[model samples]
Target: MKPADVIALPFQWGSELRHRKLFHPRGVLMSGRLERTAPEGEGLPLVSGPILGRVSKALGAPGRLPDIGGLAWRMETPEGSGKWDVLLASVMHGPLSRAVLRPILGWTGSEFSTLMPLAHDDELWWLRARITSTIDGGGLALTDIARRASGEGLDVTVEQALKLNEFQPLARLHFDGVVSGEDISFDPVVNEPEHVRLTPQWLTDFRRAAYRRSREGRDAPNRPTPEEAAEAKDS
Candidate 1:
């Protein structure tokens, strides 16, 4: 199955707080512009479920938006295998609102080049920038780097750095105000409105590329056989 196909499922995002185990005490949905209190266990670290709108209903959040959401799920696995952990992610970009993702996926626009701020904390960025400068200069013994996997305000699954195929998404998405995949991490009052834009074709292309590369890299061997290596050396 293609990553695009896999990602086509109704998307949901939220946080998986690990007070003990990998559990999602808070989860939200961007599919239908809804919010929920999150479901515990029986499914989490949330892999899949109805979108956040329906989840809001389940969690007792009134439906301001009239659209009924479909399955809501996130790629959360804080514990990898355990209990009582929170998954932090969001459905910023996923299956189209309806059957409206095809053309967007095929279009070629400059939307992807639009650099949006991925991190929110300016202070943190400033401090990290200083540390990065130190490292770039000649300093060692890492200063800004967290001592442990989990650190202060480091909601592991949500705000941590992203891997090649993994993304630590925010549970809440701000579409109108912020164009990035983060919530109102900046000055909320002045950020205008929080809104998320549709994932243009450019994004789909990027995703497809990422998926292809990931799959290929995963399936491909890191080292070649002795003969192959010898042949490479000879060549």
Candidate 2:
């Protein structure tokens, strides 16, 4: 099987973050929710943002990937499952358009369906890094990190992500997930955590984008939607 689906992958040039609600019982509450609200109680720090590496234009030509320090992590289902996959991406609020939004909706539904993780502005720092190039070939080394495979459940650490995106040193990335039951710990430099105020429209669009992309697969951990299985009910 192909390791990646580029079109469905996150950070395609001009992609805007969006959050779509999962049809699951737990996610039903996501609807009517004003904001997921930045994670609090971390007591680490409230990071602010000029969102590292944002595209200034609302939409750019094809192949305009986000500057490093952004991500689009995803997992596909096993063969024959016929389910929606999962996708997790980080966004810093630049622009949202029909060109970006429509393809996202259609593609995510056809490919990945679950919301693997929700990337927030505070997490963008992990995606940035400095690299050696210059007379030797100076340039930016950006990565949109992702797990190699889609497993029962995997814990994605911010450390690996940032390292891939911005070239943050190999230091460790550690965090606790509500359902992931994972505790991450790794290396030396912890990317700074600052909170910059992202616009409401940015957030709204991000959530919507996320929401749409999360439904990439045809199957979920729970039951299938009526549209998914004509044979599912009354069987």
Candidate 3:
């Protein structure tokens, strides 16, 4: 195995012991629609379709604490040929700062970014989402956001940029309700569009290893906690 795969073993053990995802364990499942708003361009072809999404706080932090926000979703690709999964995290809108994820106290008015560039048609592009609607007063709870979405609809604008800070509208995402009883896990590394590729092969390898280990941990048979396993190993 590669060094990255070996190094990801602990995360697998951790998830198995915790019986949950190592990151973003808690989230709200949402049902939404993505409508293409921009004309065909040199960028990715943003498709219009029904979407299933999850909004979560990284580290599974409580609603009151600042946390890295996550917006992950799955949608159909052109001609219903396949599906594309996208995972974005809260990030700044500047040139250099856009690469860094920032924790936010609430979800509203936050900007989410791909953090890494995607190669489409031999050109690099970045995807982003901006929360355009307001949720009253520290709207951090899952149910609160769900309620608002079901009633007034939570609106977000999806954008794309060839370079940082020069985003153009790509689509409008509207969350109409909370999806219940459906467990969904998004792995963009494996579920991306066929025409597009994530840049930096090393990063993709690392992410693939991590995701594989996480899935193994989640699916493994019940085992002793990491501490207990370590003690047994030491003995």
Q: Please state every model's RMSD to the true fold in angstroms.
A: 20.4, 17.6, 3.1
| Candidate that scores best on TM-score | 3
Q: After superposition, how far is residue 169 of candidate 3 from its true place, in Å?
A: 0.9
Residue 177 displacement (Å), model 2? 10
Model 2 Cα lDDT, one tens digit per residue, 1-235: 1223333335321122222122211110000001112343332122221111111111221232322121121111122222211122223222221012111211111111111212344442222111111111112111101111111211222221321232222211111112222211110111212232222434434544443344443223444455668776557
lDDT by residue for model 3 over 131-232, one digit each (tens)? 788877574666667777778988888988885558888999999988877768898889887778777878888888888998889898888766889999
Model 3 lDDT-worst window of ten:
136-145
Tens-digit lDDT track of model 1 for 1-235: 6555455322111111111111211223232121222343211122332221101111212223212111122222343332211111112232121122111111111011111222222211000000101112121111111121112211111121221222233233111111124211111112111121213445544544443433333344345656888999999
Q: Residue 51: error of model 2 in Å?
A: 23
Clashing pairs in 3: none
What ranking of all candidate models by TM-score puts the best one first? Answer: 3, 1, 2
For all predicted structures, in order, the TM-scores are 0.23, 0.20, 0.91
